[model samples]
Target chain A: MSDADFSLWVYLSRTPLLWLTVTLLAYVAADRLSAALGRHPLANPILIAVLLAAGMLAATGTPYRTYFEGAQFVHFLIGPATVALAVPLHRHRRTVWRAILPMGAALLAGSLAAMLSALLIARAFGMPETVLASLAPKSVTAGVAMGIAGSLGGDPALAAVLVILTGAIGAVTVTPLMNALRLRDYRARGFAAGLAAHGIGTARAFHVDFMAGTFAGIALALNALVSAVLAPVVLRALL
Target chain B: MRGLGGTILANLPRMIPGAALILLCQLAGEAIAHGTGWPLPGPVLGMMFLLLLLLGNDLLPEPLPTPSVTGAADGILANLSLLFIPAGVGIVGKLDVLAQYGLGLAVALVASTLIGLAVTALVFAGVARLVGRDGEAEDAA
Candidate 1:
């Protein structure tokens, strides 16, 4: 509570450096914990890091905006990292090319199922129309889903939250779900991960295996396109 | 002294070409999307642009030196999960809406995403089998 100490706190709190360090340190800790636990499905590092960051912000009464100011640097990488996916795709072109037909079929099935199942389940529960619209694109990546939701008259922020939640849920549940279903094909597993989870799921697939990661990356990109076109049409049909 | 800033800054100078290529492609993607009012994300288009470059590189008389570029890409991707934490943490700000529809939303999201994921994988696997892709080489590897 000393004047100098308080001044230092105010200064550091305003800078991107402070929260950036926190986010990294939290992730490093989470990653190590996951490794220690044999990368168990429950030990998803993003989940752990998000909880940690949220906890820190909550404890300090920091606004999400202030925390984001520091953490936007990490967010910015999603673009470059997305572009980086091309490297692996090129490296594994033959595998992807070979499975092109199956990939297309799976894309249609998965995209419709993602939107329809979410909307129907929520609607049956008597959730409102706006909620249905936003939920329709929940499985797509955040930006695209938010756009779809916005254009559909849903709350864009709510759509963004739902998209991230969908990603997190998909990331956490995918391995166990795949295992329980006895799926052994990395391509199949990865495509599903990206198809359902978007980048977060793709990140999980990459963490597990490279082949899965490659397909997941393609799935992530392709699903965005599929869902953008499908979300509006599907939502209208349902409404 | 710069904390995490040091890490990002330290990695910058040595990887200009790789960094430039990625940013340029992404920028071009944004420009195109903006110009045409495309519905697709810039990053997705950037990925396609980069893929074409990589694919086109194969047809060139001499392959380009791209170790640093790939290396830079690899480095960024290696820590890819780190990038999502920021947006993930923003969930803290949306507690009110979440609170209002917490139970239904949670069940709906979790159930639907798991269902979508499982269905996609199963369908892909089934069709791959039916298509006579024994994937012997893939399996052997």
Candidate 2:
């Protein structure tokens, strides 16, 4: 509250390194906490880290853009990380190849189910057209979902937010739901989570087991492709 | 030449080769996507490219010289969730939209995600049963 303290705060917030350091430190703390909690899906480190960072930003009155200037370094890793997914895909190639037909069928059915249910539920609640369009690709990863949302005349930024929320919701609820359904197969559980939740779900699958993670990665990539191609057409027909 | 190669490998970080391969694939993918006007993102295309490379390696009589990509990828994948936090934090800026349609959006997202997962899992399980090849068995093999 003092003048000197206020000036020091303003000076430190101006530099991008502060946000970058905060982001990493928050994640480290949250990751440790998640481990301490036995890696429960609901105690997801990313969810905790984001909340801590957002809280810090709000408290300091630092703009998202300013925070992003430093945080984008971490964001840039997503592309290469996605490419690295092929390592797992290659390791499990035989399993994936053997079920190519079933995987394709699942992709089609799951994509349609995701799009239709999202639209129908939103429409039932009388959501606007843009929100409906944005919601159409909510199951896909953020980057692809935003692109699809833009093409479908929706808000790309909103689509990104929705994609993250969808992923978080999927990650949190999937394991319990799978257990209740008695889906004991890791491959089946991973594929279903990936198809429904994309990257975050895949991350959760990886935490569960390596085999599950591999299938989840494959499902994430294939579902994105299928949804990208089919969502616009489905939206056209429905709208 | 073999001695030199060994020396370099010993000195270099273990993650470099895998990271380099992934970045190389991403760059190639970006170039191809941009040049060909593809609808897919560069990273997705890069994944396919890597897949093909792996398949090609399988066809060769000799094993590829590169270090284990899986090992390298494991390092990154372990912290994969952390990479998404920055973007998730951006949601703070969209408080108005969330405030307006928060209930509807929440209902739609949760319901649709659950339905999608259930449908996908059931279909996958049914198909796996028909095929008579348990994924766990294959995984063990």
All models: lDDT?
0.85, 0.84
Task: Give each prediction's DockQ, rounded to 2 decimals.
Answer: 0.63, 0.61
lDDT of 2 by residue, A158-208 (tens): 898898899999999999999999998788888988999999999899888
lDDT of 1 by residue, A61-148 (tens): 9999899899988878887888888888887888888899889999999999988888888888889988888788887777567777
In candidate 1 chain A, what residue range of length 10 has the lowest lDDT sum? A139-148
Worst lDDT 10-window in candidate 2 chain A = A98-107
> Which segments of candidate 2 are over 4 A away from where they belong?
A1-8, B1-12
TM-score of chain B of each: 0.86, 0.82
Candidate 1, chain B, TM-score (2 decimals): 0.86
Q: How close is candidate 2 to the true structure, as a TM-score?
A: 0.92
- In lDDT terms, which candidate is top? 1
Best by DockQ: 1
Q: Give the Å error, residue A110, model 1.
A: 0.4
